[model samples]
Every structure is written in C-alpha cells, then in structure tokens.
Target: MTSPSSPSSSSDAEIVVVDLFAGAGGLSTGIAQACEALGGTLGEDVRLVAINHSEDAIATHEQNHPWAEHYHAKIEELHPPDVVDPGAVTLLAGGPSCTHHSNARGGKPIREQERASAWHVLHWIQQLRPEQLLIENVPEFRSWSRVIDGEATNDGAIYQQWIQTLQALGYTIIRDDRGRYGVTLRACDYGDPTSRRRLFVIGSRTHKPTAPEPTHSADPEDDLREYRTAATIIDWSDRGESIWARSRPLAKNTMQRIAEGIRRHCDDRLAPYADVVETLGPEDVEQLQDDVVPIDDLETAVKERTEPFLVTGEVAIADGGVTGEEPDPGAVLVMGQHSGAYPRDAQGRPVPTVTTTGAIHHIAVDAFVKPRNLPQRGVHSNATYDPGAQPAHTITARNHDGHLVSPYLIVYNGQSDAADVDEPLPTVRTKARHALIEPDLFPWGLDIRYRLLEPHETKQAQGFPADYEICGDTKRSVRKQIGNAVPVNLARALGAHILSWNTPSLSTFGGGVTADPETEIPAYAEVSSTDD
Candidate 1:
C-alpha cells in the first residue's frame, strides 16, 4: 500500500485535501481553482487526493487532475491510514452517493449499485478529522432519518445526530438566516447553466464559515451577471443534416409535432431559407428580429424573441404552411426514442444528429397526477400508515415505509418543458434526458435538428472547461459521471469562502472550539442518540 507522504514541512498555511466520492473531479477542480485564486501553486502549496470506486470516474478525475493522487477503492473498503495521514489533511470533502435519498429527478442511480451513504462518510470523518469539511447532496437529504425498529423516529433525526456529533468534535457548521444548518443554493445563481438546487453543509474547526454570495441573477435589476444560457456552451459547428435527406424518414407523430411547431413557433414568424440573425442583446427589442432579406414581409420574418420555435415539415410546407393544423396542440415536444434519451453508436459515444426532428418546445404531453380527493379509501403512500386505508396492499413485516420514498421535488413544476437556447438549462439529470433543438436558422432546408445534449456540453454547463475529458466504457456511464457532479462554479464559490478564512483561532493540529456558542439547531433537529 503506497500512501501519499505526510507534510514534508509542518506549514500550517499549506492546504491538503482528500475528496471522498469525488465523481469526475468537479469538486476537486473547483477547490483547485479556489486555491489558485488564493495565489498558491498546485502540488506544492496545495495537494489533493481523490477517492472513488468507479473505474471510469477515477480515470476521468486522474485525466483532469494529474497533480493529485487517487485512490480507486470504495470509501468503506479503504483504511484511512493507508490513504493518507490524518494530521496532513486540512480539508475533507465528499458528496456521498445520494441514489437512495434524492428525489426521482435528483439521485438517479448508476447501473453498478453504489450504496455508500452518510454513515460511511461519518466513519471516515471519525478516522480523519480534517480542519474543515463540506458535504454536497440533493436538498432533500435534509430529511434523511435513521431507521429504528423498522420505522423512522422522526424526520431528519439522523442528519441532526450527524451534525451534533460533528459539533461535539470541534467543528462550526455554517448556518443561514432561517437557522438551517447548511446553505441551500441554486447552481445557475453562480452562472452555471443548469438550475440544480443542492444543499451544502460546511463546517470548520478554525473559524466561522460564511456562505458564498450569489454572483448571477435571474432578475436583471441585480448588479450581478445574468444567468448563462444553454446556447452559450453548444458547439454551433455541427448544425446537423437537412430534414429531407435523412436515411430513415421522420416518424408520422414526430412530423405532426414538427408541423405544429412550425405553425405556432415559426410559420409566419420565420424566413425558412434566409440568413441567420445575430443573437440579440437585452437592449435590442420587444421581440428579437432578423435583418435578413426574406424580401417579402419584414414583419412576419422576425423570430418571436428567445429560443428556436417548431421548425418544419415537408408535408406542411407542401400544403402551403398550416392549413388549419388543429390550432397547434401546443407544439408536439416528445422525449427521445431511447430509454435515457440518447442514441449511441457502435462504441457508445452520443451521436450529434439523428433522423428525427428530436425534442422541441413545439409539443407538450398533458401531465397528470393522481387526484388527491378521489373520494377514495386507498392510501396515497405506504408511509401514510393507515393499514386500514389500504388493507389489500402488501404489508411488509419491516414496516419501514418512510424509507421507501421522498415525495419531494419540482420535476416539472415551475420549470419549462424545454428551455430556450437563450435561457439557463433545466436541471441536468443522471440520464441524457436533455435534448437539443436546433432550428434551421437559414435557407439550408434542414428545418430543425434534435440530439441529446452532448457530454462535453453538459460538462461545460457545470462550469468545467471545454478540455475536460470524461471517461466511460459506455454512453450511460459517461453521462452519469457528468450529471452527478457538483457544479464547478458553485463548488468554487464555496471553496473560496472557506479558503479565505486565513486566521485560525487555534492550530488545525490542536482543535479548540466545538461549534458556535450562538449556533442554533435547525427547527427539524431531533438531537438524540442512536440508542435512544
């Protein structure tokens, strides 16, 4: 076992980091950026050791961060001493597998079951009590409770216990205005293209930690930078092929959606075969316009503001453009043919173009939820626990129904079906659910093209640079690594806040304070022992 050598010289100013469950180096990249932002050189002043069990993930992390040492073993399998000396680690960071606790949209599991949870992290923390530590997970993780007698005693009972234990171990957790133990942040607020909401629990042994302030805003009135758009990260060079020249013809339902998209989104609004217009600035107009020579109707030709609209159809175009197409069924936007939405090649790389029109804002499926007041005797969930309400349902002997689900998240609520190219992306998922909608901006007769958002695109959206390489044997694996990452910009913001605290009340070598004297436990806190 070759462990990283301990601190060559005992410089309290140096930063040593060990990233547990470091998926594709997102947090590591951000932390390194934060360190460099503080004027330190990599490998000399700041060193990193990344840990993960996934082969491809560790390979990806090693590819990007060559300066850092890596341990390709599960968190529970590796001994802390064999990985690195506890005394040398200044910062310990992790994003333990959230597959079990995260909402449906949040912790979509990778095929290879990765079951390490906060317990593994807690065990490791007990072994390597670094001066500062931060944990990242889906916001719903705040509700995780320990299972006792096959039932949860209370919501967040486990999390509260974890925090109190850390506090007892001489750490000060960051708190927000609402007295929440951690800061909850949106990725896009820090200029990341994806609007993923995540919870970050930051604790420091030295000084009080501050939450990073938002640097971008949805509101234009704020002095911060405007949120970035999906169009910004895309490689426009691959505009896709002409709609008429596909190897396989477009599907009937898909063509129908395309026609509707044309009617509602384009038709009178766009010049099918004209010069592409320059993207408009906010100061530009009531609706974004095209200055090209449609030569006929300048009024009808301008695109109706942001994002590409329903593109085209040979049937509709041949029929002289929308002969009363059912008042346009809200622009037929269906998901892709594959289970995860991406079409792969002989080797699993996501193809840039496909035969179909792909997913667009031109169509919508009527979303439905089971009526809350169906005049029913049926139980909404097993956790609701009126066994009488659902007498016919299987009653498990364990009775740990609350552990079965977390009925939380805004999967479709408050979010658009498809975001405009000019707007921030919807939350990136573990699967390739996000698809591209490319409009035939000019007279190429291509109409609009669709493809799953490429891995590189999603990576850049997470604030990783274009050169960052993601390794995987298959397409799903590659996408999972990218989707599961902490947004680099958001992590950088958090890292900056922690690294900037220069003066430690006591040496990290000798711990002093244990949490804030004024720190308030969260309202959901049930600070009780496991045996209680």
Candidate 2:
C-alpha cells in the first residue's frame, strides 16, 4: 500500500493497484510479474494495496508481496479515499468472495447475507474511479440474483443490474461472447500445470480491454507451447508414508486403487486388469465375467503376477495380516490414495486446479525398495490428520469446518472411475500417479515406499514461484492460502492484457457519453448495504 501522504511511497510511482478480497497474493504476484515483463522494477515503480477479511490470508499475502500494504478487513469497511488517492490507482482488481455463487451450493437462492460481498466492489469502483477494473469469480456468479423493490427478479437480475451500474459509471465492460473460453479460461493455456478454469471480467474507463491470449495448449496444431506437467513440478523425493509401514494401514478400496494405478500407469506388461476387480465395487464386479476369481484366488495369483501385495481391511488375512513389528518382506508393491475413477494420471500432464483441502486428499507414491535398513523420516507434525471420514467442507479449508488436521485424504476405492460417493473429483490430476518398480530387477525382500504431493509442489502447480513464502502457522493454513489463489500465470496474462490497454480514451466509452463536452451522464446511485 503506497500512502499518497508519504513522500517516499508513490509520489512518482508508475502504477498503484488495489486488490480487494485478495487471497494469498495470487493476483498480486501475477501483477508484479506483469510489471516486470513490462520492464518495471516492482518495489520502486509499482505499489500494491491488498485487503482481505481473513487474517491468515492477509498475513500470507503480505509475506509474499512484502512491498504491498495489506489490510486484514472486509472491503466494505475500508474507505477507498482513506486508503489510497482516488485518482492514483490506475487499476483496481480483485475476485469477490465466490462462496455464495459456487456451483457446489447447488440451486440454493442467495440470501441477503450472501449478496453484499460481491456488490461491495461497485462501491469501491465508484469511490476509487480507477482507469480500469478487473473482477474474477466462478462461472455461476453470472446467475446471481436478488430481491429488488419487493419483487423477485429473474435468476440473473442482480448480475444484470450490477453490470448496468458499472456501465452507468462510464466503464467499458470487456467480454467474449463466443469461443471455447468466452470469459472463462483454462489455466493450463497460460502455462499452469493444472486443468483449472476461471471466469474473468475486465473493464476500462479509457482504453479498450482484451482477453489475454493463451501461452500453452493441448493441441500441437495450435503452435503454442506445451502445457507444464505434474511430473515436472512434483518433487519425487518427497514420498510420504511407505505403504509397507504406515502407522495405520490403507483402506480396502485405497489399496485396490493403487494396485490398478501401478498396473496401468507404469506400462507394466502384465497390467492389473484382474487386480482392478479386487478393488472394484459389487456393481462393477457383478458385471465382470462369471469366471473372475474371488479373493481366494489372490494369493496364488500374486505369486505369478509380480503385482501389488495389497493388505486391505477385508483381505488382510491374504498377507497373513502383516509382520508383528513391520510389513513382511517382499509384500508391498505400490500404494496411493484413491482420488478419482481414473486412479492414475500420466506424469506428463498438468494437474487439476489445486484445492484448499490439503487434508482430505491423501498423498500417494509408487515405489519398491530392497529390504536394506534405510532410516525412515520422522512423522510430520501435521500427520495427526485422521484418515477417517469427515465432511467435504471440513477438509476444504474453510475457516472452521474440519478436524483442524493439516493434510488428509478421502480415499475412493473401487473399479468405477467415480467409485466414491458425493465428493467432487480432484480436478484433472490422476489419483495414484506413477512410481515404477520392476520386481524382476530386484531380489525378493523389498520395501514399499510412497508419499503425497508436498505443499510446495501444489503451490508450483498453482503457478506460485518457488521462493514465494506462504505465511501460516500450520500446513492447513498454508494449504488454505494456496487453494484460494488465482493461478499466477493466468493472473499475469490478464495483467499484461489490462496493461496493454494503458492509453485511456477518456471520451466516455461505456454508454457513448463524452467526459469533456458531450451530454451530461448522470451519476450512478450509491448502492447501500441495505439494498444488498
């Protein structure tokens, strides 16, 4: 935050930016990168003011964007005039809280309590009157509505009215009505390694705003750079708990999913097609050939297939329930949490958009080790997370829903792609990714080793720079910040696009009125919180 009153802050700075509902500096980082791309040193030439209601989020953002001024309060409480010079901010940007309009809420109508967060941006725009405004949200935000004048309006009335109000304030709304990504875009197109999509709305008071072009693509014919893959970003060295020696053991379905994931993903010649049945639900198994053998056949088959030595809850007797002190040698092959029906994803592909639930989604690994005495890493402080069942929102990193555990997983075991019940699939990232081990290459007694993706790997997948510090006392806190972030590469692309429209065409472009000598344009009504 550059104080206009401070002589050294921004008296001669090139740009001033304000981020409302700024979550962990995703947008700010990208904006700073955009500034650098445009040949400006961030600390000297640009000043960023970040505001958010979450104290932890504010701390995280401040730590990462150290040069920026941060406010740990809601946007509505801060008077724009007191925070920054009205005319100094060339760009005003932020994604309002999308909790109300997310598709996850289903068709529930937004109550009064849920509407004010998004509407607050209009007030800031009126007060700050920046040359440009950029807003981000989930696609369902367009369907928002409110009760106006004692009569319920259409489903999208609130958004329509908001847009009209923006137009009234002499701002040009930049939109893309056609194409694959009208206003919503996939982050992988901008070099993010995940397959997350977001909606962006850009407005300009002076120049015409355009969408950022894609930098990477899935199709080679497009001539764009290839998408960054999960394999490239993941730290292979950080495999978490070994399947062989977990303090607690894997769930029945989870072990089954790993068996299939290793069989299919590792390019093993004799893949685990029959092994998949061992992990499948009754529905899937019932559909299989009647000749398919039951668990009774697993032990004899294991001796021949060189496959995973699964120790599930129901099938523990197959492996004699394990060694008294540790897993029997030559027992475990690969282990992973069940994320989706696919179970395993190719390493050379971007992961799905990261989420705040660092807990519920278990980390996975596929490795085989010789039975030599290798020292084990101490259990992580955050390992207290219960692998038992919990609500979806609890693990989703909301302020107060979960068991306060850092990272956990909702292990979905079964043969079907969507074997789990009611959980949103972990974006596009595969569930149990590859950790190859050829049994023939190793002597008999071997260890099974594997781990989940570390916080840093998840952060990088979301496009945050490696050195950027996420401030929080706990792993859950750090995950909350990362999950809530906009992709940095996507943000940078948008920033560059907005910056390209730097020249303000001051002649009232929104409603075709002129600022200098044309017909007078009436001022937009200041919407009160009561109206929200």
Candidate 3:
C-alpha cells in the first residue's frame, strides 16, 4: 500500500482527473472547459484519463477530446496503478451505469452485478488515494441496498457501506443538514436548457469542497439569470431541411386515433360557447381577428362562425389556390385540447425532465371537415409547440423510436415568433418522434408530418457545443451516447467549484483547510456498533 505522506513535486499543481464510465466525454468536456475558464491549460493544467466499456462511446469521447488518454474496457478488467503518490491525483470522477437505480425502470429487480460496479471506485481510490473523489448518479443511488447471493440486504446498506469505507480510508463525505451524503443538482440551475436532476457525491481526503452554487434559476425574482430556453440553443432557421431523418410519417392506425382524439376535444371546447355565440353581433365577431381578443369572446366566435361552417370532401385547386367547399354536417371537425403531452409556455422556462421516451404533443384539428385525400404522414403521441417561445425537451437515448410521443413546434403561416402561444416544451426522449400539423395540406382539419430530431439538435439540447462531433456509426448509437451523458454546463459548474477549492495559490497542500485527523471518529465504526 502507498503511504499518504508522499512528497509533492512542482508538477503536482496540475489537476489530474480519472473518469470511469465516461460516456462520450460529457463530463470530461465540462471539466476541460472549466479548467480553461479558470485560466488553466487544457492538457497541461488538467489531464484526463477516461475509461468506458463501450467502444462506440470511447470513440466519441476520443473524437471530442483528442488529448485525453482513453481506455475502452470494463472497470473490473483494469488494474489501478500500484505506485500511489498522495496528492498526485487531484480528482477521480465518474458515474456508474444507473440502470438498476433509475425510478423509470419501474421497480425491476436490481442487478447485483451492476449495483456492485460502484465498488470499482473504491478499488481505484484504494490504489491512488486521490485528494478528491466525485461520483454522479441518480438520486436513488444513495439508498442502494446490498444484494448477496440473490438475497437483498438492509435498505441503504450499500450506500452506508460506501460512506463507511470512504471514512475508513481517511476521506470526509460531504453531506447536507439531513445527513444525506450526496448533493442533488438540476442542470437548469447551471444554465443548461434541459432540466436534469442528478445526485453528486463529492468526497475529500482533507478539505471539504463547497457545493456548487446555482448560476441560473426558474424564479423570476432571483438575482440569477433565467434558465436558457430551447430556442437559444437550437437554430430555428436550419429547420433540419438537409437532414432526412427529421420528419417521419405516422402509421394509419395512429393517425386515426389522433383524428378521433381531436374530434372529441373540439366537441368539448365548442359545447360551452354555443349558447353565447347567438348573442354576438358583426362588430363583436370582428374582434376575433385581433390577436389579443378575450378568451370568452374568441370561444363564442369560433363556435358560432368557425364551427358552423365546416368544409367537406376533396378540396379543389385552381392555379395553386384552394377553393372553398360547402359545409358537411356528417363529417365532424375536431380540435385537440392541451393534454399536457407536450407541456410548454412562452416565457422560456426550463424544459421538464428528459426520459428515454421523448415528449408527446397533442394533435389538434385546424378545421372541422374530413378531406377525401389525407396525407399518409404523421407520428403517434407526438406534441406540437410554438417554436419561438418554448425550449427543446430533454434529449434521451430512446428518441430513435418513432412510435414514442415527442414534441413538435409548429411555425404557422411563416410566423417566426411563438411567444403569443403559452406553453413549455416537454422532456425529450430517444423514442418519442414529433409530428408537424399543416392545415393547408388536408381539406379536413390539418395535415400532420412526423420526424425524429437530428443528432446535432440533441447534442445542442444537452448543452454540448454546436460543433461537437457525435461519433457513432448510426443515429441510434449516437442518441444513446448523448442521452446517457451528463449535461455539459452542469458538469462544468461542479468542476469549477472543485478547481476553486483546490487552487494551490489559495490554500495549503490539501487545497482548503481540512478537519484534523486525530479528532475524527471512523464513520463506519460508529454505524457498525449502533443497534437497530
């Protein structure tokens, strides 16, 4: 075993980081950017050593960070260096796969092997005894229980054991007032457009690093800047025209369901306003043309003038102009309600939590008539939004599936601003595809077009640089890499905190002031001796 009293050299000023389970280098990118922002050289001031089991993820990481030394292998297979130099490694960081601890998995039996993967950090820590250790995962990781021989141990036993083990190794685990060992952070608080809440366990051998302060906020009264919206990161003018994968056609059954759903919704909306419409005059009806018409008055006009005159049958085109058709009472035109599928508002609030399934927007009917020839293109459970105001939802790996519901923002009649439409973008997922509703395409209601988000857009939504390369052979592989990654801005903020706390100029050998070793009791010993 290496002694903790190893002498430090001039080169020790540099912050050396080891990233385990590094997925596409999101964490590394943030750390590197943070180092540079703090007036440090990328390769010299902070060196990175990354390891991952997936070859594709490693390839992506390498493409983005060419200077870092990367290993494409499982953590169990790699042996830590035997020669341990105390204070040589500034930080050891990584998040194990969260499959077993994720709430989204629906209480599936925990995979003991995967849960045990966290032990790899202990193994490396034992070998290197780094100054600081950072672990990121879902919130449930703190309550992880041990499973031995397929039998579950005490609840939170694994987490307790980990804390105890770190304490025994001469490290102080940072905790909150509730004695919680990890700090939960939201990506939006750090100026990332996506709202991803993740737990971070920061342990120090000497000084306790301060928790990262939020630089952005959802509340308007706070001094901090408002969270970045989806519109800020995404290039609306691009429209993904060059990318063929952006739009997909919905299946016949899915379209029929959406059509029926819209019809029912319209009936509900128009029912209340039918009686009030009879009392309105021509001048009162003309008020509907104004953008700021009252909701009550608009409802009356829509039910009286719009609902009563529904077009039916095939639409005729004369020199690319649409010809009006007579009303068909038998064909019901329906508009979809705000079903909360694609939740958004015009105030540019932070997006909701991103899941493996993308956000789904409700499909609404623009007109109340069934056209003879309907466009055969639309997505299932997809969401439509006002493109200018809402931010993109959280991007997830499952976005590759077309059947899943996702958000779709509509740009109506060449109108660029969607601020008038109130709503926020729902979370982005890998499988949820989006559907675009075009009223002019179909004689009845609106024509819906479906498509998946482009890889670049997904990267942007996750706070990655727009020019960042997503190195994967297929879009699915790329989506998976992006989805599993930590938001770049959040990681950068944490890294900056670590760097600020460990600056040699500001403190002594251990970075900041540390608790005296002689006065402390072993956390593990105390817990072990306690009775239930």
Model 1 residue runs over 4 Å out of place are 1-13, 105-116, 146-154, 240-416, 438-448, 502-532
lDDT of model 3, residue 338: 21
Per-model TM-score, in order, reads 0.63, 0.64, 0.64
| Model 2 global lDDT (CA atoms, 0 to 1) | 0.50
lDDT of 1 by residue, 102-122 (tens): 554233333223333677887
Question: Mind giving the per-residue lDDT tens digits that candidate 2 earns over 116-199?
Answer: 777899998998799888898877677667655533343765676677678788776665655211188777778776555677
How many residue pairs clash in model 2? 15
- Give RMSD (Å) of candidate 3 vs. truth: 14.0
User: How do these models rank on TM-score, best leading?
Assistant: 2, 3, 1
Candidate 3 lDDT over residue span 314-375, tens digit each: 22222223233322212322222222222111122111110111112222323211111112
Write down the TM-score for model 2: 0.64
lDDT of each: 0.52, 0.50, 0.52
Model 1: how far residue 337 lies from native, Å: 29
Clashing pairs in model 1? 261-310, 273-443, 331-362, 331-363, 332-362, 332-363, 333-363
Model 1 worst lDDT window (10 residues): 404-413
